[model samples]
Target chain A: MNKVVLYMSMSFDGMISGHDDGPGRGLGVNGEALHAWLSDGGISPGSHRPGVGVNAEVFDEMMQTGAVITGRRTFELAGGWGGDHHDGVPVFVLTRQLPDQPAPGHARYVTELESAVAQAKEAAGDRNVLLHGGSAARALLDAGLVDELVIHLVPIILGRGRRLFDDQGHRARNLELVSATEGADVLHLRYRVVSR
Target chain B: MNKVVLYMSMSFDGMISGHDDGPGRGLGVNGEALHAWLSDGGISPGSHRPGVGVNAEVFDEMMQTGAVITGRRTFELAGGWGGDHHDGVPVFVLTRQLPDQPAPGHARYVTELESAVAQAKEAAGDRNVLLHGGSAARALLDAGLVDELVIHLVPIILGRGRRLFDDQGHRARNLELVSATEGADVLHLRYRVVSR
Candidate 1:
């Protein structure tokens, strides 16, 4: 089975992105701080930017995913990831309505949550699906669709912003630790969702 | 100088304790799930409980602390930790006013944040001070007083609860990764606060 793994960079307080994350300010005020690990490393072949230590390994693994799924807000913020998120992989955007132009990329808009997850899984085939965090993560976790979670725990406290897990009527979920690796500016933690 | 360290077990969403975590319900509904590792390990000498794998080592280090500082609410919630939080060490309870005939234990009430931290450090001498999370942790972080943070990153999401880090009017703070250790039910991450 192709696992749908959710990856995000979060602060010590759990903010995935900073406050005011929208069209004008995609990552919000100082939201890019969470991705400091990617900026502090030496990039080898097939790597995006420069990621030091475990950040490089984690980013490499994410780049190798077969497909990418993101929510509408994040999709718009990223301007559709130029249609393909990584290495010619299919990008599936979960949204209620499709944008007019979609920034000239290879992203396909899907209306229903189940359909998007199913199509992304099928597109992934043998490789895993790279799921974005924030609103999309909450939806997938609530629906019991995420198979694993890779949280690059940033060593800072934004104190406020968008959360990754949830704050609504969510029940207790169980997970098993797959691995924990230290990056230059983050702790790379991998957990397998056992039960929701 | 004695270092003031904050330790907390947090959910994937950054909640330290679950909803309704006061008075009667200490850990809150299903909040104990974050502490499964403590219950899954063998009881080694000096450990508070049976902690599997890294949990035992973490617990042992926590028990060796010379003093404990906690907020009034958490102090009341733990029923004062029988007055001595661990091994007869002094307990510094931060509160606006002293509790009338507080729970039987070795707790002293301090009305000011600086005073509480100072007293804890003085009492600890060369040993590290174990500062509780929640309000005290937030205050210490905001005041640029905390030296290190040890987060036992649990694998569950409670959805709603008290967060360890502040959310209102808090600036970004930087930290350096000291180590990352994986336990049976949690990932033990130690970080040194570098910037405020």
Candidate 2:
């Protein structure tokens, strides 16, 4: 069965991106440190991405997903990942205000949450649907739509910024650790969301 | 010289204890799950502590610390750990108002943060002084006094609870991973505070 997995790079203090994360400064002020491990082996010329060697393992695995879903803010800030997140896979975006003209990429915006997830799951077929952005991840997690989490737990504590988990409510969530891998100055933790 | 190390057990969502943590309820609602790994083999009759076997590794390591420091709220809630946090080690409580009668334990109340820390460190001799509770840890960390962090990363997320990292300003703190050990159901992560 296919799964809906969230891939997020978070600092030890739980910030997904530093404060002041907007259109131009996507990762916020000092949030680049969270993703520094990705560029440890320098840019991969073949993939044209900032990840190689052991550091790129997670990125490589993320690229293999059949489809991707993102929240509007992240989609706009990241410029829709130039249409295709990976391998021209369908990018399903959740947003209330849909753009009139689609940006340069392969993103399809939807208003409702379930619709976006359902379409993304269908588009993914037998492969997993890559969940992107903290907003979308939180929403999916709160709604119990996400199946797994692939968190690149960075060692730094960015005391400010957008958190992957916040303002959700007082509902306790349970996650089972599936795997833990050591990366270059990072820990790649995979967890199965058991309860929401 | 002995270092000031913070020993904290935090949930995956960064909660230290659940909501309604006061007076009698120290761990708060559903917060006991975080410490469940410590008693996997049930309570140890030898030490009269709730930790035994392989799961008690961190607990055993924690028990060896010479002295301890804790915040006023947590200190009062835990009843000052019956005055002996461990082996009759001096327990320093940071509070503005000193109690008229000390609780039947070995706790000494101090008004200032530095005094408590200094006394605890000096009392510890060559052994490390354990920084107990999130409030004291935050104050010490903000003042650049904390040297190391030993976090027992629990897998569950209690959505409503007291967070160790909340309310602190947006100053990014850097930590170098000293070691990462896999426990029964918890990940024992030790990090050296490089910058506050």
Candidate 3:
């Protein structure tokens, strides 16, 4: 069975991005004061540049099981890719405006959050589902679709920014910590979502 | 010269509390799963008990500040008081819908973020101002009024909760790391806000 997971970063105050849709204000954007710990990790957390991080094992594990899902804003802010194959993994973008099949070899866009999740499960096959950011993740969570979540807490506080989850309703999903690794500013934590 | 500072723990995915409107969700309702590491702190981060970690030197320093600010939610969640008084220190409550003032010392509500900043600065006299959360901290940051930020990154990822900053707007503030202390699952980091 595929488990849906939400993994992301937030500020000490609990904000996902800076205010006013400010560019570069994601999570600890203007306030990297706390999150500068991630600078040691090289590239920024949201940037999808490959071949980074000395500890890619966990990220690799998180990615190996399923297709990636994200919102359009997240897709564009990370400087949307010319090609969608993330280290050879297919990605499904949740957007109401994009085409059903944005790319044949690597990417596809879907409007319905349910179908996107279902397709992601299908794509995962025997592996678990890794639910990426944007509205889709919130939608899945609100619908009680996600099973597990792994959060890479980068020490930073934007004091404002696009929230990882705000107003989006999600039923309580009890969780058990599977592992914890201390990286510079990013604390990698994996959890098994146990139903209470 | 009031140096406004914000300090708090947040989820990896950017939530401040789980089920913010639900019972016991004000502290870590959905965040319990994400912040399980705080358990090692001998006191859960969301205990909401006044003086839970009040004995720390950091807490002493924080309490001695000239001014303190927080959102109404936090004030209410904290059950009004947390032991000692501010010794006539000026405490500002950031809110549009003001609630009845808590007993003992004095608290004034401000609807405008800039006014609150000005008031905090005036109240500080010569001391630094401490900007705490619910949403008032976010409002101040959104206005680019905060002078410094100190975040205690607890090593836990609450899978669900209210976020620190979501898609608001604020300018980038460069920061210089002044200290890093590993206390239980929380990493206490202090930074001087830098400018572009």
In lDDT terms, how accurate is model 3?
0.59
The per-residue C-alpha lDDT of model 1 at residue B184 equals 74
Error of 2 at A123 (Å): 1.2
TM-score of every candidate relative to the true structure:
0.93, 0.94, 0.58
Candidate 3 per-residue lDDT, tens place, B85-196, comes to 3656766777776556543356666667778778888888888887777477667765777777766554443554566655544444445556656544455667666552
TM-score of chain A of each: 0.91, 0.92, 0.74
A97-138, model 1: which lDDT tens digit per residue?
A: 777755346688777888888998898899999999588888
Candidate 2 Cα outliers beyond 4 Å, as residue runs: A45-52, B45-54, B102-104
TM-score of structure candidate 1: 0.93
The segments of candidate 1 whose C-alpha lies over 4 angstroms from its true place after superposition are A41-47, A51-53, A99-103, B42-47, B51-53
> Alpha carbon lDDT of residue A27, candidate 2?
87
Candidate 3 segments exceeding 4 Å error: A1-4, A7-66, A70-84, A93-103, A108-128, A152-161, A172-196, B1-4, B9-103, B106-130, B135-168, B174-192
Q: On residues A1-196, what C-alpha lDDT tens digit does candidate 2 reach at each position?
A: 8999999999998899888788898687779898888777566554534455556778878888999999988887877777877889999888878789764577888888898889999988999999989889888887889999999999898888888888567467788888888888888888998986
Candidate with the larger TM-score of 1 and 2: 2
Give all candidates' CA lDDT scores.
0.81, 0.83, 0.59
